[model samples]
Structure formats: C-alpha cells, structure tokens
Target: MTAARSSFGFKDVDAREKVRLVRGVFDRVASRYDLMNDLMSAGVHRVWKDMTAARLNPQPGETIIDCAGGTGDMARRYSRMAAAVQARRGGPDARVVVIDYNAEMIAAGIEKGSAPEMVWAVGDAMKLPLPDACADAYSIAFGIRNVADVSQALREARRVLKPGGRFLCLEFSRPSSEWLRQAYDAYSFKVIPTIGELVAKDRDSYQYLVESIRRFPDQPTLLRMMREAGFGQAEFTNFSGGVCALHHGWAV
Candidate 1:
C-alpha cells in the first residue's frame, strides 16, 4: 500500500511528523500568538470571531468546549455572553473550556485572564480530554488546519457534544474573488512572515501557518468531513469574500 501523506505547510511528511512539527511551531510562537493574529489579519480576525460568537449564541448554564482554543479568545467572548444571560435569568453561570495541546498557549491565555469564569486546559483536539456528550457546544477557530488528522478531530468534536449540540468552526478559506485571492496570497506569503520576523521573531512559524491554511480543505470538503464524522445538517458561511468561513454542524 502507498504510504500515508500529511502536510506541514507546503511540505508533505508522515502524519505523526507533521503533528510534531506543528506543535513545535505553536510552542515557539505561543507568547505572541494573539498579537501575530492581529497583525496578520489587520484586526479583521476580531470581527470574524465576533461573528462566530454571535452565531454560537451561547445560553445560560450551557457548557462550551473550545478545542484548540489558543489564547482563549472565543472562550472569553462566549463567557461574556453566557454571563449576561445568567445574570438576567439568575441562573448558574455557563461553562467555557478552552483546550489546546500547546501548554505555552494555554499559559498565555491564563495569564491574559481570558475570562475569570472559563476553564483553560492543555489538551489535544483529536483526543479531547472530555467525556462523551458532555458539552452543549463545540468550537475551534483558526486551529483545525494544524491538526494532523482533521477527521479524527471532527469525530472527537462530535463525540463530546451532547445530542442536538452545535459545532462551529471559523477558519481560513479560499477567496472567491480572483483579485482578492491574489492580493491575499501575496500578503499571506510575504507580509505575514515579515511581520512575524519583526514582531514575534519567528518567521518560520508564520510561514508554516500561511502554508497550512492553503493546504486546508475548502468549504464543501470540510462540510463533507463533518457529515462523515456524524454531524447533521452541516453547512458553511463564507466571510470576507471567502477569505474566511464559518462552518456549523449539529451533533444529532
């Protein structure tokens, strides 16, 4: 049988090796990850994240597991929403768990005070350290592309979510506009790494991140994967002319 192939940026490698490389990249850049995000996306990432949170519509007393939740951005946003609902309803506060395999990333998140009410843990997306049917919603933003086994991560997401729970992901995608795509490609391949070098002092990590986004599956392919992982009624909404996309699926 032919050997399995996995992507590490523009390079192909064994699946396990790819995981190790990705972990190393994150570990090296964890301290400045959030800042790099802002610089790379020109602050548009915050808008994308706000859109994701709006769609999630976190409710009072619900549990949200944010896998690969580096720096806990989504968790913090969700917690604020949940807290408001709880305060209004006079119920117990909702729970938001931010899990990532990179310990350094989790540490940075905790140090930033990413919502006093949320839980932060270092855990792998493909093998989440959560019980089955334990979460009311699951989310991963800008992190799934780094996973070595995207399908396994999707399966784990489905496993942890309760029946009728929601699965939401925000990720980079192919831009529909040819002109925009060309500009984005130039910025991603050139400006991003240069900024990483000047700011984060890690050009290689940024380069890998950009390449990984290019290697990620497009909108339709990811929906199919979610369906194969037992999610129902999977769909996607592109943002910024498909520069990014929000994918929603239900565990049924």
Candidate 2:
C-alpha cells in the first residue's frame, strides 16, 4: 500500500485516508481557519453560513446536533433561535450540541464561548457518539466531504435524528456554468494553496482541501445518497451558480 500522505500537493487521495489527512490539516490550521476563510472567500462565507442558518428554520425547545460543526457558529445561531422559540412557547430551555473530531477546532470553538447553552464534544461523524431518534434536526456545514465514510456519516445522521427531524448539509458543489467551473477550478488548484501557504503556512493541506472538494459527490449524487440513508425527501438548492449548495431532507 502506498503510504498515506500526512500532507500533499494536488495528488489523489483515498476517500478513507482523506478523513485523517483533513483532521490533521484542520487541527494545524484551527487557529487561523476563521481568518483564512474570511480572506479566501472575501467574507462571503459569512453570507453562505447565514443563508444556511436561515434555511434551517430552527424552532424553540428543539434539539439540534451540529456534526463537525466548527467554532460553534451554527450552534450559537441555533441557541439564539431556540431561546426566542422558548420565550414564545413558555417551554423548557433549548440548546445546541456541537460535535467535532478535531480537538484543536473544538478547543477553538470553546474559546469563542458565545452561548452558555451550547455543548461541545469531540466525536466522529461516521460513528457519532449520539443517541438514536433524539435530535430534532442535524446539520453539517462544509464538513461532510472530509468524513472517512460519507455514507456512514449520513447513516449516523439519520440514526440520531428523530422522526420528522430535518437534516441539512452545506457544502461546495460543482459550478453550473462551464466558464465558472473552469475559473473555480483554477482558483482551487492554484490560488487556494497559495493562500494557505502565505496565510496559514500550509500549502499541502490546502491542496488536500481542494482535492476533497473535487472528490465530493455533486448535488444530484449526494441527494441520492441521502435517499439511500433513509431521508424521505432529499433535495438541494444551488447557490452562487452551484459553487455552493444547501441540501435538506427529512427523517419521516
């Protein structure tokens, strides 16, 4: 077997191997992840994440599990939404559970410390340390493609979601237009790694990032996977001309 690279530059990587490689990269770059995201996307990631949150439509006193949810951004957003819902319904307290395998990212998330109601755990997506039929909703943002087994992760998401629960995934997708796809690929393969080298001081890691995005299943294929995982109504909406997408389904 070829030795799995702890780092690489524009090389093909096994899907299972991607999980470990990505974890290492994210751990090393955790402190700079948010900053680099801002720089790389020119602050557009905030808008994307905001759009994802809005589509989730979280309600009060509902349980949400944010798998691979880095820096607690979604957790914080859900917490605020839950609080409002509770106030409206005169219900019990609601909270968001954030789980990620990377300690560095989880630790960085804890440091942000935005909401008292949010909980953090170091856990894997392929085998989530969560109970079945418990979460009212589950979400993974920009993190699913890094999983060792995408299928298993989707199953785990299904297992933890209650009946009528919703599942949402926000990720990079293939560009719709040929010209845009060409330009996007150019940026991913060239400029992204350069940014990583200059800002995060890790060129190889960004190369892996680019490859993982390329390897990830496109919208229709991913929706099919969601159906295989038992989600009743899997669908996706493309954003930014398919550069990003929001996939949603139900555990009916």
Candidate 3:
C-alpha cells in the first residue's frame, strides 16, 4: 500500500512524517511562540483574534472548542466574551476547551495560566477526542493551515459542533494589493526567519511557518472547503488588506 503525502513547509513527505515534523517545529518554538507572533505581526495578530472573537459572539453557558489553540489566546478571549454574556444573563460561565496536538504548546498554555473556566486537552484536529455535537462553537486561529489534511480537520470541526453551532477560523491569506503583497513576501521570507533566530533560536521552524502560510488555501477556496465539510453559510472577511482573513460557517 502506498502512503499518503503531505507538505512539510515546501517539501513533500509522507502524511505521518509531516505531522511529526510540524509537531517538532511547534515543540521547538512553543516557549516563545506568542512572543514571536507579536514580533512577526507587529501585535496585529491580537487585533485579528479580537475580530474573530467578536464575530463568534460567544453566548453565556456555551461550549466552545478552540482547536489548535496554542497558548490559550483564542480560548481566553472567547472565555471573556462568554463570561460577559453570562454576567448579563446571570447564567453559568461558558465552557472552553483548548486542544492542541503539540504537548509543548498545551503545556505552555497551562503554564501561562489560562482562565479558570478553560480546559486544556492534547488532541489532533483531524480526530478530536470529543463526542459529536459537543461544542456550540469551534475555532482555530493561525493553526488550521498546519494540519496535514485540512479537509479532515474541517470535517472534524463540523462533527464536533451542535446543529446551529458556529465555526470560526483566523488565518493568513493572500494580500489584496500588489504593493502590500510584495512587502509581506519580503518580510516573511527575509525578516521573519532572522527574528526567529534572534528570539527563538530556530530559523528553520519559522521558515516552515512562513512557507505554510503561503501554502494555505485562499479565502474563497477555504470557504468552499468549509461548505464541502457540511458547514452552511460559509463566508470569509478579509483583514489587513487580506494579509489575514476570518472565516465563518454554521452547522445548521
């Protein structure tokens, strides 16, 4: 039997190998991942995440599963939104689960002191360790592109969501303007790895990160994938001249 192939950065490798390689990259940079994000995006990633959470509009007592939620950033943000809703309604706190395949990343989130209402789990996006219809909303921020099989992950996301649940994804996308695209390319290829070396002492991992962003599907293509995965009303909103995008879909 032949093995399936997938991308590890620009290199093609066996699917299992790609997963291992990707996990290794995160393991190497887990401790400094959040810092590197700030350096790479000039603190703009926070704005993107906030926008995603706003669109999610988590309600009180909801169950949100943040797949590949490294360092608990999205989970924490969702928790805050849910908590606000709960306070206004006088309901119980919302439940958030932060799931990551990389144990180091999960450990980093734990060590960083996630919200008391949040739960952390080590799990794969392709096969989440949760029952069907378990979440009111599912989100993956800057993490879906790393999955070896994005389609499978999308299916998994849909599988975990209750009917009428929401799915949100925040990821890098093709820039809308030629000038901005050029500037981003130069920065990504030339500057990001240097910053990675200086801050995380790992250039190859950051290089892989940049390459993976380029390899990810564009906004419309991803929306189609979401629709194909059984999500209804899949749509995307571009951010920062399309340097990033927020994708929304519903399980109806």
Candidate 4:
C-alpha cells in the first residue's frame, strides 16, 4: 500500500515523515516560541487569546484540555480564571491539562512554573491519551494546523469531550479582502522569515511556518470539519480582519 502523503510546509512528504519534521520544528523553536509570537504579531496574539478565553467562559471544577498548549500560556490563564471562579463559588479548582506532542515545549512550560490546577503531558493531538468523554472543554490555539491529520485531531477532540462540552480552536486564517490578503502576504513572506532568522535563528523553520499557514484550511472549511466531527452549532469568528479566527462548537 502506498503511504499517505502530507504537507510539510509546501513540500509533500510521507505522512509519518511530516510528523517528525513538525516535531523537529517545535523542538527547535520551543524555547523561543512565545517570544517569536510576540515578535511576529507585535503582541496582538495576547489580545486574541484573551478574547478566546472570554468566549470559553470556563467554570469551577471543569476540566479543560489545552491541546498543543506550548509554554502553558493560554492553559495557565484558563487555570487561573477557573480558580477565580472556584474561589467565588467555594468549589474545587478547575483542572487544565496542558498537553503537547513536543517534549521541549512541555519542558519550557514546566520551567515557567504551572498553577496547581494545571497538569502537563506530552501527547499527540490525533491520539490524546485520555478517556472518552473526559473533558468539559477543549482548546487548541494556533496549533491544530500543524497536526498531520487535522480531521483526526478534530475527531479526537470530539471523542474527549463530554456531551454538551465546548470546543474552541484559534488558528491563522485567510484575510477576507483582497487588499488585506495582499498586505498580509507581503508581510508574511518577506518579513516573517527575516524575523525568524534574527530572533529565533531559524529561517528555514519560520519559512515552513509561513507556508503551513497558507496550506491550512480556511475558516468555513474548518467549521464544516467541526460539524463533520459531530460538533453541533459549529461557527467561527474572524479576528483581526481574518488574519486569525476563533471557532466554537459544542459536542451534542
């Protein structure tokens, strides 16, 4: 049987090979991943994340899985927000699992110190090591596009969430206008690689990153995928003129 094919940036390769290449990229950039986000987005990523969290509306004693949750940025925020809700309601703190396939990224998150409610694990998005219907909410921010099989990852996301559970995904997306697309393309292609070389010292890796974004499915397609994976009320809200998008679906 022929091996399945996958895109490693613009290049097509063996699906299994794509996994290794992605891992290597994350392993190299894990230490500086958050920094690179800041540099690339000019700190706009933080605001987007905050908006995503607000939409999540996490409650006390809920279990949230932050898949590909590098450096625990959003997971830590969710944990604290849940803890605050618990403090007010006099209930147990929320449990947030920061699960990522990259061990280096997990190590970086650990180095930053985690909240008591936070749990760390190195696991693949397509095959999360968790029981069925085990979580109340799931989130993957700017990370799902990197998965070798985005459909499988979405299926696993549905598998892990209890009925009535919520799932949110934040990912880079195509701009809505031709003018914005032109501007974004110019910035992404000409500027991001140079930033990567100067800041992350990995030009090739950043080049792949840019290519991956272009290769990723757009907002409507992703919403359709979520629906196909058994998520009800699947919808998306574009952020920053569609440079990024936040998708929400409920496992019904």
RMSD of 4: 0.7
Error of 1 at 14 (Å): 1.4
Task: List, residue by residue over 175-247, the lDDT tens digit for candidate 4.
Answer: 9999999999999999999999999999999999999999999999999999999999999999999999999
- lDDT string for model 2 (1-252, tens) is 775442232455665576667778888899988888888788888888888888887776778999998898888888887787777877777768999989999999899776866889999998988889999999999999877678889999999999889999999999999999999999888898899999999987788788878878999999999999999978999989999999999997
List candidate 1 stretches off by more than 4 Å: 1-3
TM-score for candidate 1, residues paired by index = 0.97
lDDT at 232, model 1: 98
Q: For candidate 3, lDDT tens digit of each residue in 88-126? A: 778878899999999999999999897867999999999
lDDT at position 125, candidate 1: 93
Candidate 3: list runs displaced more than 4 Å. none
How accurate locally, in lDDT, is each candidate?
0.92, 0.86, 0.93, 0.94
Write down the TM-score of every candidate: 0.97, 0.92, 0.98, 0.99
The RMSD of every model to the true structure, in order and in angstroms, is: 1.2, 2.7, 0.8, 0.7
Better of 1 and 2 by TM-score: 1
State the lDDT of candidate 1 residue by residue for 187-211, as single tens digits.
8998999999999999999999899
Off-target runs (Cα >4 Å) in candidate 2 are 1-17
Compare the candidates by lDDT and give the number of the best one.
4
Clashes of each: 0, 0, 0, 0
| Model 4 clashing residue pairs (backbone) | none
Candidate 3 weakest ten by summed lDDT: 84-93
